[model samples]
Structure formats: C-alpha cells, structure tokens
Target: MNERSPVRICILALPETSASVVYGMYDMFMSAGRDWGLIVEGTPGRAPIAPLVVSRHGGAFIAGNNVRITADAPLDACDDADVVCVPELLVPPGEPLAGRFDDEIACLRRCHAKGKILATACSGAILLAEAGLLDGLDATTHWAYCDFMSRQYPSIRVRAHRALVASGDGERLIMAGGGTSWLDLALYLIARLAGIETAMQTARINLVDWHDVGQQPFARLARTRQAEDAVIARCQSWIAEHYAQPSPVGAMMQMSGLPERSFKRRFQQATGMSPLAYVHTLRLEEAKQMLETDRQPIEAIANEVGYEDAGFFSRLFRRKVSLTPAQYRRRFGAMRDAIGCISETR
Candidate 1:
C-alpha cells in the first residue's frame, strides 16, 4: 500500500475577522490543490480530500458568501490540521488582544505541539506571540504593528522589513506581514506542499502577482523608501550607479554639488540616514547578492563591494547581520543553490 499522504488545512476565525484574509487563503488553497492534481478526490484513485474550517465560537460565520459554515469542532480541530491559519483579527487602537485570549493561546499550543504548520496574518500575529509560539523566532506582522509587537513581546525577533517570516525548521511556523499578505502566505504554503505550477495557476486565476515568500510586502518597501527627499533620491540614484565605489558623505556632497552642511541636513531629512550609512546599507544588500550568486573569495567580494579590506568587510557584515560573511553565505546561499537546482530540474 502507498504511504498515507497527510494534507489538511484549518482556519481559525475570530469575531470581526478580515474577510479578504480568510477567503483569500481559502481560494488559494482550493485553486492550487485542483491545479496540482493534489485535490485528493480529484486524482485517479486517491482518498477523498477533507478540508475543515472552524470558528472560535463554534457556530455559523456569515463569511459574506451567503454561505454559512458550521464549525463542528472547537480548537481541537487544529490538532488534526496539517496547516492552521489564523486570520487577521479586528484590533482596536491601543488594545492588546480582545477577549477569548486564553482559548486562542491553548489552541495555538496544541497545534504547535502536533508539529502542524501555523500561519498568521496581520494582527493575528499578536495571538501567536501571546501564545508564546513566536518567542526567539524570526517573525513579522503588519508594519504598523511592529513597534507594538516589539514592545509586547521582546523575546520575538520581529522583522518589520520583510513581508513574511518562517523560522522554525521546515517552516512550520510562519507569520505574514500586512493584511493582504495572507494571499502570498497561503499560495506559498500551497507551492511548498503541492507544487509551484499549482501556485502559478492559482495566481493567474486570482489575478495576483504570486510573489515568492521572500518578496517583501509593499508596505515594508514603502517604509524603506519613505525617507526619499529630493537630496535622498539623488543620493540613492548615485548610490545605485556607483554602488561598487567608496560612498563617503563628502564624495556624495561633491557629486551632488551641494555644500557639506546643507547636503547632510537635506539627505538626513529625506532618507532618515546619513549618506555613508545609506551607502553601507546598499553595499550590504549587494554583498548579500554576491554571496548568493558568486563563488568569489571573501576578499574579492569585499573589493567588489568597494571595501578594500576583507577583514573590514567581515566586520561590517557581522555588524549589519549578526553573522559573518561566510556564515550568511552558508545559510542563504544554500537556499539560492536549492532554488537553482529546482529550476534546473523543472
């Protein structure tokens, strides 16, 4: 007999949940499973598929489809689910989490203990973090909640800059940033468990871009570019052009034809960082790419990134990223290699 394929999904819905977040996930899963021939019953001779969706209150939730789904089981439904998604909760200003806190916490713990993939959208991350599932884990929520989450759970390594965070081994625990990121997160799960072709078809049907898990959310990208003042935009353009050169503030001012004091003020006002600091960020980003794509020596990589001293490059890389260049290369570079291998196989 063939080995049993375990693929089940459960959504935990709360009161006043975001309709888009919940339905988007549901749509993606259904469409992708169909496209991939992973829809269980749709296959030639496979077991019937069982998809369950439960509400926190165990009743009919009018999810705007004229469709009412009865949640037969309570949080116990999470235990049997291969993937459990917590949709975006309705959070009032200055409030932590609404009531039903204790029950949600217990449900998350049970699901996590069973080694099920746990995913959350927007302020739903607050629920997971409060449940202590995100402690010491790299996670992200809506960018607006970054400061709040950091203050609420200092143990969680909050990444406000990224769209999604998946830190546990095999990416069992994932948190998506922003409200709409639920679409990407759900499609990503489908791709991982099902296949990329399924995800692509789903995206085509949904009229979405089908961004990869690594793609930063639009909100995070906006925040990154929020400091774009006239001077800053010019500096950014120059940095893009000369990213491989030494990017000292004096050099930037000279290139921009601005006085030193004026340039410093204008640049800081626009970009939230000193010229040199911004340049370092750009260089580090480039170095990340080099580390992933090239097999060059650290010294050569440093030189290509405009750092003459390999030791200096290592120090800067460690300061920017807690890991040395080689370590970063080992971790993320291997991921790039795996992606390349998959592409080749395809």
Candidate 2:
C-alpha cells in the first residue's frame, strides 16, 4: 500500500505443486517495482510485492518433483497477506481431490471470506473448485482439464479456451490457464494491487509477455474470451447465462450501466464483437451444443436460443457458422455419437 509496505502475496505450496511455478512467481513478484528502475535508471525502486510460501504445515518439505521447499509461514499465518496465490498443482485431470487438502481448502475459504483476493494458476483451480468457492462463478483451468472441471462441478461455467478468467463477486477470484500464463496472472495481480505502471515495469525488467491471444489456439478451438475490462467482463458473464432471453444486448447494456455509445465501444473493445454479434455468438454456441447432444427440432432449438423465426435462424446459422443447422447437426451429432460409442467400447 505504501513505499515501505509492499503487497503481501502468499503462495500456497503443496506436495503435488511444482517448484518451478512457485519460485518463478516468487522471483517475478520480488522484482515487481524494484527491478526496472534499477536496471534502467540505476536507482532502486520500492518492491511492490512481498511473497511468502505457505504449506499445509509450518516447515520444510519436498515437492512432487523432488524439489525441497521451506515455508515462510503456515496457512493460519496468512491473515496478514493481501492476496493468496496457488501455483500449478500436479493432480491428474478428473481425479477426485476429496481428502488431500482439507486444511488448505479451509484456509482459502477463510481468506476469501475476509476479502483477500484469491488466485490460481493451471490445475491449482481444482483446489478452489474443491473448496466450493467457484460455485456459480465462471472459471477456467488448463485446457485439457476443462471438460473434467465442468463435469465435476456443474455450477461452474468452465471457459475451456480462455487463458485467464476473473470471476466471483468483485472479481476477486482470478485464474490462469496452462503453462506460462501464470506470468500474465502475476502481472495482472500486480496491476490490480499496486499499479499498471509497476506491472509494465515488471514485465519490461523480466522480459515476460502477456498471453493476449488466449489459449484457444493452443487448445485447437477458437473464440474471443477477452475480459481485461472489469465492467465488460461482468456483463459478458451475465450475458452468457441470459443469452436466450429477449433483447439480450439491451439487457447487457443496462447491466453495464454505461451510456449507449460508451457501452457499445467498451463491449467491442473487450470482446472482438459488437454487442449484437456477441449475443449471437453465445446463442450459436449454445445451439451447437444442443444440436450435438439432443434430437430436438431445429425450430425448437432456434426458439430456445432466443431466435423466434426458424427460417431466419437457419439463414444466420449458415452465414455465421458456415453450415446449415441440419447440416451442422448431422456432422457434429454423428461425431458425438461416435465418441460415445468409442467410450462405451473402451
């Protein structure tokens, strides 16, 4: 908060957690405000982040990959910290984390209740999901785990292709997708807690880059899940669930509480789509899911996704999705059936 008082960041360490992520985050956080100024201007700047590692107990232990770690404090000692971050954990996707982290999960709940900003990188999100903290909140993890996460926690809107996601009330729950996107998460946290200038300086000093293009390309999927703007992010999440409602764009504009022109501009900037286009994308995505999994009539699917006229919906589907509604269903629906059969045989 001040020059002398840095943002206290507590990193949770577990036996299954990777040491590289833990220490990589530690090094970057330690250099937040202090490195760039000294490197360029030859004057030391105030350190913006003070990182502390905490484990289940109050001592040293070996991590999953045989790396020894010493904790600065136990989980109970984290009350003084401003934010608690969970680096990647090496748990298997779809594996239940039922009894492994009772103490760690409780600590997170307590910290979140006290309004401490809670964050996770990669499969560390599983711990947050295990804590029931992500209930009814949009979230993401490594792409491979997206389906497992959705299946395990149905209340969570799993954004598989999003490299980063900020959800929950006040957007206090932050998560990053697989790999080095944790650097982006750290920079974003510094920007949120300290200042954007310091975050930029940290990036410049560390030679780290933001993953602006997101993980969809990596996951071999596509779409815009951009949400750098907090207000626009909230509106986007709102419209995701309510896309089937009448006049959804107007509803999002109202939810954003911005002037018509301002809301339109910000929405476009935040997502690469106009307000109407954004709503249409969401509706079409839902229609695709329904078509793949259900045998409902095309008219029914169209109407359910907020399109009243079946003919108009068919035209738009072809124009935007490059396939007729029936054609899209026949292709992907068969794929789904084949996948189901394959799974059954296996």
Candidate 3:
C-alpha cells in the first residue's frame, strides 16, 4: 500500500489589515503545491472545478471593484489544516485585536493541540504570542518591536538579529518580522514542506534571493588589517573594546603612536566613518541590544552605554530609532505580553 502525503495549509485573515502578506503566502504555497504534484489537474470524469482559496468573511471584499474575494468558510475550517498561517494585523491601543481575536486564538490552540504547524508574519506574531505558544521559546519579530517583545514576555528568549523565529520542537510555531519578511517565511515553509528545489523555483519565479536561516537581513562592516595599517587596526580594535568608556581621540592616537592628523585620516578611510561617530554608532548598537534584552532601568541602560546622563541617552536613542527609551520599552513590553499570552495558552 502507498503512504499518504500530509500537507494541507490554511491561512487565517484579519479584516482591515494588510492583505499583501496573505496574497504572497498563498502564491508561494500554490506554486509549490503545483510543483510538488499536490494539486493535480482534474480529469474529464471528475466533478466541476472549484476555487482553492476560501476567505473567512462571507462577502467579497471589493476595493473600488479592482480586487474581489469572497470568503468560503469560518475559523472552524482550520481544524483539518496541517499548517495554519496568520498574517500581520494593525494592533490598536487598549484593545486585544480586532476581527476575531478570540476565535483566532481558539483556532491556533486547536491546530497546535492536533500537532499542526502554526506560522505568523509581522505583527501577526502578537496573535501567536497571545495564544500562549511562544513561552520559553527563542523568537524574534520586527527589530522595531524587539524591545517590546522581550519585556512583555520574559519567559520567551527573544533575539533581535534576525527576521524570522521558529519556536517549539520541530519548529511547530514560527514568526516572521515586519515588511517583506513574509516572502522569506513563505519560502522557508516551502523549503520545509515541499523541497529545496520547489523553494528555489519559487524564488526564481518571484525574483527574490533564496536566503537561508543563517543569513541576516543586515550587513556587517568588514574588518581587514594590513601589515602597513597595523596601528590603525589596533586603534579600531581598541575602540571596539572600550566602546563603553569615553576614550578620546588623543588616547587612541597615543595608543597607536601616530600623530592626530594621520590617525584621524587613517581611521576614517578604514572605517568610512569619523572616529567619534563610529564609537557613537557602536555604543548606540550596544545600547539597542541592552534595551531589547535587559530589563534594566533607563538610567542604568544609559550608564552602561557610556551616557552619563539619561537625557543624553534618550536623545541619542531618539536620533537613531525615532523613539525614546520609554517608548521603546513600552513597545517591547507589548510584544512581550503578546508572547506571554501565546506561551500560557500553549
């Protein structure tokens, strides 16, 4: 007897949220499904053709008659799905989530209880976290919300370096960061569910780089030390090592045994940024990490990042992130809560 294949996907949609993620996910899955022989052509003797996608809401959502879609079923349809996807939603203040939060949570729990894969994209991670599935798991969301995720859900280990996070054994729960990361998540799912070939084909069709989980969205500056530029390299290393300390330019020049003009020119040419600017950038990056991972007070965070005054830290953080320390913490706190909710329910 032949073994049966088990791969069924069902994506849940929230009203009034971004639909691009859903469409993108659907396209990737459908393409992969065709490639994997999951969706076969109908025979002449078979019943009439039917639509594969079914919306949650009943009526067709027509935006100026340009786009139209009619929902086929409700959240209960998720029970038979092997994988369930939730797209990003615009969260409002003082409200859990609009458009079937409780129902979505129940559906997620049901799916997980039956060993189905649960995936979320962008702010949709909040839904999974609220469902209690992300507790004590290594997860990440959009970098902008990393701090909020950490504070709200202290049990879950949050990392800010990546665009996607998979939690639980066998990667049963996964979350993708904001923006176009939905594409990455869909490709990841395709690679796992179908095969690498299908994922590669899909990537080719979409003209997207098929990135591996190990790759980061951001590029790191390269550090190359030549024999002639030993002093400059050493000074750069010192700056990296003593970023938290207020090491003046004079100190760097003295350490390198080079004159001020030479040191300044060499450092700028090597690093592409002024010496003090580079130091400030490093400190700010460190401060960002501290803000996301640590639960320390604002003043402590400022001091740890070499800011003598909390106000200065706030100003720098704002300049870099367009958000103050308090605002950053609040955002991460919300994310943490969302994650905590998911963990508890799970």
Clashes of each: 1, 0, 17
Q: Order of candidates by TM-score, top first?
A: 2, 1, 3
The candidate, 2 or 3, that scores higher on lDDT is: 2
User: Cα deviation of 9 in candidate 1 (Å)?
Assistant: 0.4
TM-score of model 3 relative to the true fold?
Answer: 0.55
TM-score of 1: 0.56
What is candidate 1's lDDT per residue for 1-346, written digit by digit as tens? 1236636788877654755666557656766645434433455323222356677677777653344555656777777788888887677423756565788778888888878888887778888888888888898887667656776787988887677778776778888877677887876776777667656666775787633433221322122343336666766776666877654666778877888888888886666456777777677878888888989998998998889988988998776555678977887799999999999998
Residue 203 error, candidate 2, Å: 0.8
Compared with the true structure, all predictions reach lDDT values of: 0.71, 0.86, 0.67
lDDT of 1: 0.71
Give candidate 2's error at residue 115 in angstroms.
0.6
Q: Write the per-residue lDDT of candidate 2 for residues 215-267, one digit (tens) a residue.
A: 64344213345477999989977887798999988888888899999999998
RMSD after CA superposition, every candidate? 11.0, 14.8, 17.9
Off by over 4 Å in 2: 220-346
How would you encode candidate 3's per-residue C-alpha lDDT over 86-197 as one tens digit per residue?
Answer: 8776653123454557777877888898998888877677777777788889887765455456656668787655677788978889888766788888888878876677
Candidate 3: residue 88 Cα off by (Å): 0.7
Misplaced by over 4 Å in model 1 are 1-6, 35-50, 62-72, 211-346
Q: How large an RMSD does model 3 have?
A: 17.9
Q: How many Å off is the CA of 252 in candidate 1?
A: 28
What TM value does model 2 have? 0.64
Candidates arranged by lDDT, highest first: 2, 1, 3
Which model, 1 or 2, shows the larger TM-score? 2
